[model samples]
Target: MIHHKTKVAVIGLGQWGRNHARIYAGMPNVHLAAVVDVNSADLRGFAHRYKAEAFTDYRKLLGQVDAVSVVVPTNLHFEVASAFLETESHVLVEKPMTATTAEAATLVELARRKNRVLLVGHVERFKPAVRRLAELARKPIFIQARRVRPYDRTRTMDVGVVMDLMIHDIDIVLSLVRGRIVEVGGLAVRVHNSQEDLAGCVAWLLASRVSADKAAEIEVTTPDRVIRLDYLKQRLAIHPFHGEVEDMAIHGDEPLLAELRHFINCVNGEEQPLVSGEDGLQALEVAHRLLQRMSTVAPPVRV
Candidate 1:
């Protein structure tokens, strides 16, 4: 029952944070109160474009806004997000929750103690293709997911590919399947010097920072049918036991916008977050196991 606009801020004016600021400025009941970044030059441009105050330090912008989107690098997530939650502001933190499971658990507990809405930015869960897959794959037995992209120094520099890219599929697969992960395994290679870590797993999951083209594909096996999803195209293909493959009619929306809108709704007491902090922790825990598994193998020597 929000009758007035909610004051919001976007922190870390990197590529993703700028998009959050843009989307929030356009929303009807949200006020883009502030944008924060260490890079003063970029901060001024975003602040001018959105007509919102810009701050070089995030702490100065905290008390002014009712909620904040923390799109900072993965390493800074826990520090920034916990500060906001301590102040009782709702937060929408970008995925992987934090660099470690212990930090994620602490945030989850603090959010509960403060009675705040803490949401994670697992944008894939809002995809029409994934939404449809959730409905159709009622008993998914196995899932195969591939998320590959050309080496981009701007992304995943703070973390490995499993956390940056594959974590999306990990969250989605955990959502579709019923049982806990009893087993896990994988392999990862570092094809570029910018990679923070060369770690990946092989348990039906593959993510790389070495591909020539951008690709995101997932295949799910259920009792009755097999489902395939292309994340970039937002398409879903289903194969029944007796009939030919059928393409699902997907009614898609911009995932980041939908995710942010959901955060606003939660802030307004209209609905619970589609992806909660605990859910993000679950995905992160699985990702850590994958990383731990990959750590056993010796990484290729860089020349």
Candidate 2:
């Protein structure tokens, strides 16, 4: 018997990109071919650690790898991922797909035209608790998610809280519920930074760069029961209308690792991506609608 390893590259060597590279390097059937970043300093340590070639320009790595993980900022997602797709390499783009629906649509079309596998990094969908919730909630009448984070001025300044944090919840809800969103209404506040830092839609999102605690939780209501998920604790609880609440057993697996393994399987033609480009676009569309709704509602006046 013979074995072949897929060549994988990680672009934009930031926090998430580095993690992607680390996982790919550790995988048995993947060759961590290269790591790309505009910052040579960012490329050096990770490339050396992973024993992969480093390139400052992503274009140089286009034809060199079988697949690439586009872990760049939201704005650069389209440019990087599309380039890889154009070169006929499979791509696993970080969540929110692209900055706009138009860009996302373009990437989806390009991937279809090229017959390349395009996977979106909706990591939460692979979480044990989320998967259990999807199985348990047969008909979700109402879904509420709260993703609050403490002040961290260093991350996600390119987009607001809704895009940064609520998007995960949005993707998960859309996956579980079969109905289209008939309407959306929400409020947002620029509590700390001039940027909008907090939002409340059907789900409440608090991506504050000024908060005191961190939390991630979701609750789903069906006709017969309510399911609660604690993302931080990785737990799921089911409350029936006429019985006591039951704590569901959830396997403690890292969502990102599961996501990457799924991507690898998809690239190998062993399975389809759990989260497709269309799914990412849908979630992005919902996030945009929520933002539009928030824009109409006036923020509270601060003294």
**Each prediction's RMSD to truth:** 2.1, 1.9
How many Å off is the CA of 154 in candidate 2?
2.5
- Quote the positional error of residue 11 for candidate 1 in Å: 0.7
Score candidate 2 by lDDT: 0.85
In candidate 2, list every pair of residues with a backbone clash: 151-209
lDDT of each: 0.86, 0.85
Model 1 misplaced stretches (Cα beyond 4 Å): 154-156, 194-202, 296-303
TM-score of each: 0.94, 0.94
Write one digit per residue (lDDT tens) for candidate 2, span 182-229.
788787777666667777775543344445688888888999998899
- lDDT by residue (1-303, candidate 1, tens digit) is 647999999988888898999999999999999989997576687699889998889999666679999999899999999999998899999998999999999999999999999999999998877888899999888788888887765663777778888899899988888468887777666556544233445557777777888899999999889999998888899999888989866875688888998899999999998899999999999998877776443457779
Candidate 2 to truth, TM: 0.94
lDDT score of residue 223 within candidate 2: 99
Task: Mark the 10 consecutive residues where model 2 has the least summed lDDT.
Answer: 202-211
Kindly report which residue pairs in candidate 1 clash with one another: 185-202, 186-201, 186-202, 187-201
